[model samples]
Target: MRNIMYAAVGLMMTTATAMAAGTPYHEGSATIIEPTDERNPLAEVVSGIDFRKSMIREMQEDEFSNPGMIVVDYGAEIWEQVDGTAGKSLSDVWESCAGMDAATAAVSYPRYHDGAGKVISLEQQINYCRETAMGAEPYKWEKADMLGMTAFIRYQGNGEAINVSIDGPAAATYERGKELYYQRVGQLDMSCAHCHEDNYGNYIRADMLSQGHINGFPTYRVKWNGVGSTHRRFRGCNGNIRATKLAYGHEDYVALELYLAWRGNGLTVETPAVRQ
Candidate 1:
């Protein structure tokens, strides 16, 4: 969700600026490179803009509390199911472990994990907590059980503003991700900016692709019949680009997500459970 923001802004600026300067793209892919001379000024747009406040406003008629509920419901069952060597439930260790009570905590994750030595997404964070902290095995990212647990957890933090940091190592990772967002890659030879930044709000096949904000995720994703994680959607975009996607728990993705969240620092979170 965050990374898409950078791509959208950069794509728009990349084209609009090029036309104004009368700079021509020496290109195969859709991206226009930075011009050497001011008069010949086609340049790659910097991928740091966040556009969530306005984006969320569009969904004011909708809400962000439902996804958490659905997930929380499923998560409770998962938590209660016996597992591990002793076949013990969460009650054997922690009384609640926020199963339903702390759904809001999901909104605050994808944070820096000093032990992991990098920023990790909420999905990854939950798995780690479940494994080491809970003395249970971790759930897979795409599992219905895990996804439900995550949705329920994140649901706990409805209505809070997004806050992300790029200080220290996170800063470098964000910059690199920014560069990756703008650089053309793969057989399509297109970077994220090519479609998202350069062609936002334009018709893509049939859909009028908006600026591609991340505020709506963990979107209800009606297509999925329930809520979804932001990273799952991110990987879908990469697959669409024909680019070899980074892994689910890739550090690059966490870095990119961090940068994106920072870009959208003031945006409100909206979840799937609540329909607009």
Candidate 2:
């Protein structure tokens, strides 16, 4: 069954790559405009607003209308439920270690842990907490439960500034991530900076490009009809570029997440952000 699923994913990725290769953006004919220039014709008109449109934006603002909140609610339940050999809930373990609520815990994530001996994302830390504190098996990266729990935890940090560290143990990994951002790959010979940095506030067909910041993930993408992690979106973008999509929770993705978080250091946390 697992092999079948892997084959299905591989097939889907190939199809997506084939489709993307035909687009003008992939063909290198799409107009690239500067995002920083207010006088640039595309500056005012092109914005991240294209991602959610208006209706989804309105829906996102209303907590009751947002479907993603269902996952958040479920995550809250998981936070308190006792499981594993340690027989403790996530909430209990976190509170004991950090002396704070989950919301604050969410803010200081993708941090370097002495015991883990590396920098880890909030999602990775959650699984670590589960395994060590609760003596439970770690949830799969693509699992719905993991998404739900992550959303719920991140919700607590909503509106807080992203402050991922690049010092000490995180320094080397952070550099690698920065390199990845600028390293050109795939048949199109594009790096992340090509579209997001050099050509931000530009149009590729009807779609407008932004800096591709990760401040709002795990975002609720309307197109997906569900909340998705940074790594999941990374895979989609990689597929679009006809590049090999890395597995979820891979060290490279985790390192990339760290660098991206630092890139948007001053931005407010917008987990469960609505996107098209």
Candidate 3:
């Protein structure tokens, strides 16, 4: 069964590579579904991927299947715990989504809103609910409270696929995000696709680059050993392209994420809040 799965994965990689050549994605190597850096859509992964040791594959094993579940548990703990002037938990402020499905949410996001008056990231919307409906002070963007809440809430729909919409009023943000993805900026004169789509699966020193997919983030990265915000990863990529770094919760990032969510339509979301 293990070899079968590996073989299946190998087939998927080959198919993805072959499909990548004919598809409309040729910026850098775009990653499809593998964890290695070399699995890019742009170029074939050559030399030294350690495919014999796939962390993502290992995570699928029963021996280590609880990472996603773990983060969700911690998120639940923090949600019910009291904090702020009202000293109320998240349940106190808004509709108690204490045990609701969160995993299905990633795809529904990067949506448009006429009333809110701007594009919103899923993270910001959650904080908005906690602060306004619950009357609690908003948690810091990088706070344990935020990360925990994100992990817990989003873990609800783990196996479900992504479903972002760009046609509604929210389409404007998506449009902006798409432009940002292709726009050349920074001193290095690079775009997001310069490396990700065009270079897809190649090596960068110890790393085997994969396609740049946003669907699986708030991902539990092995190197970081924790859940990290998509924006942090975006910033790192931006810096790598020699672009000026944006603030942690900048609007540009919100726009970019909206675009990314759109690009990664139909993919599954594995939020970082999940236990690893």
Best prediction by lDDT: 2
lDDT of 1 at 58: 36
Top candidate (TM-score): 2
- Residue-level lDDT tens digits of model 3 in 1-276: 999999997887776555434222232333334322221233332211112134454563332573645665778897678766667777565344312235445456655543356777767767766665566677777556676677676555555666666666776877788789889988889887776566555434444454565654565666566767778788877887788889877888888888766655555665542212
lDDT of 1 at 24: 19
**TM-score winner, 2 or 3:** 2
**Per-residue accuracy of model 2 over 90-164 as CA lDDT, tens digit each:** 887876544446777666667787757888877887888889889988988867879988899989998786666
Model 3 misplaced stretches (Cα beyond 4 Å) = 1-53, 60-69, 82-88, 92-104, 273-276
Better of 1 and 3 by TM-score: 3
Query: Per-residue lDDT for 16-81 in model 1, tens only?
Result: 544433111222222222322232112332211121122323343244434445565776677667
Return the TM-score for candidate 2, rounded to 2 decimals: 0.79
For model 3 the local lDDT of residue 54 reads: 41
lDDT score for candidate 2 against the true structure: 0.73
